[model samples]
Target: MGRRHYILPDCQIRPGDPTDHLDWIAADIIRRKPDVIVCIGDFFDFPSLSSYSTPGGVEKEGARIKADLDAGHAGLERLMAPIHAERERLRTGHRKRWEPRLIYTFGNHEERIDRPAKEDARFQGVLGTHLCEVERFGFERYEFLVPVEVDGVWYSHYWQSSHSPRPIGGTVDNRLNKLGFSFVAGHEQGLRYTNRPLPNGKTLHGLVAGSCYLVTEGYRGPQASNEWRGVVVLNDVRDGNMAIPMSLDLQYLCREYAGEELQAYMDKRYPDKDWSHLA
Candidate 1:
């Protein structure tokens, strides 16, 4: 329950990353100026921990599935630079100040690091016991993809309704339908927004964000078109209650007001594409 919480869903950063939306997001953050920014999980795709990883592929100095730790750092840097710049600008602006707390929730793909540490004692904790190497970037890290509550709304990598007698399907609507509280999550990579009435004169809404990756390679293919490619902006929050204003979706923002440069990037990526469905 913050005054404003901007939710950025799973990125699964590696190859073909820092998607066109990354630029749009950085620019949008400067314009919207939220109270907090939450990167909801799967920020990294440690292919080394993938169950389908090939030993030979891992051995080569290069591999399609393997991710580079340094590149991940670079990608984070590119995405965060604008936010930092804006903060500095506001600190010395004519009057009003601007500074939004940054947060990252570790998702299941990030947990891939656990397998190596568990299987081999020698490699255990060899690297820092965290997902993002840029922990020095002044972000509060949440482990196990635990959701954080602000203004009564929950933000997490994904919602696991353990309270339910049995498991519910993994989808935005499924989680919102089963859980009593409103939440925003990423990891399912699909966009679903639903709201239902409550007996207490309130309503519950669930928002599943789209991905920020450039393309899908394997399991993430086929249905990749269904995955959204933007961020979610939450504002006017009061006691965890909020109203969608200015922008409710990042992709919507980019499509509506994106600069020609970004449009060119999308055009090159999808030359034969039509986005009438998004309209």
Candidate 2:
């Protein structure tokens, strides 16, 4: 029998970003009870450690490491709260626990945590993945860019180019041609999926769906940021085959779980920001 897998794209959870969507995801997980849950990392956006700004620049001001870590931890707690509650409820009822396998593949943003320690020996033991306490949440954490296979499909934050370390940039079909296997990744914004038939009678699936958080990156501007933000559910998955793939976008999730329209929610929460894309 094939297993159902839930895939969460890049969340990039950070301080100041709204995390209500995570709650929606957790609720959906409770309803679906997928056999496996995979987070394509970047769960923590450590802007404090970002190299995008000059050292000691105004943009870096007031960006505390603790704040970044705390925000991510809190967001994670929120994401798991409903699931935990469901587990407890089941235990109380003497029912079997819905203990799905949790897997987290580190992304580029989370890799920023190591820069400080790698630069100076003094910070070596202090800064690392342990501080995120992902394992505490029962997630089997994989290092940034490392691929892990589950139920015959492979997953990574993003697959690298054959000649360079940078992530392979292309459409789903292009990636399928290059990698030539069943792979799922999160890094680029929006979603793209394609599959090809193999001579051996199995199919190869490729998917890239990145944006999953409500927070917008100013650099992407309105047009780019407007791309779909959501989670994916793969069903009948076994031996690198996914018979059914479903995309639950933010708009749908908000309406289904929170009883609120996504655009309205965004406007009410971030009144000053422009979300013209939703229009």
Q: For candidate 1, which ten residues in a row score worst on lDDT?
A: 58-67
Question: Model 1, range 1-279, lDDT digits (tens) per residue?
Answer: 348788877777775444556766787778888888888877677665566766666333354433555556667787788788778877777658887888888777777776677777887767433646557766788875577887788877777658753324565567777787888777775566777667887877777774766555555445445445667777777655567523344446566566444445455667675433333
Q: Give the Å shift of residue 16 in candidate 1.
A: 4.9
Q: What would the per-residue lDDT of candidate 2 be over residues 1-279, giving only the tens digit for each residue? A: 999999999998878888889989998999999999999988899989898977798878889999999999998899987887898899999998888999999999899998888999999989987788898787999999889999889999999998999988868899888887899999988999988997888999998988898877877786676788999999999999998579999899999998999888888878997656654
Top candidate on TM-score is 2
Model 2: worst 10 consecutive residues (lDDT sum): 270-279
Clashes of each: 3, 0
Off by over 4 Å in 2: none
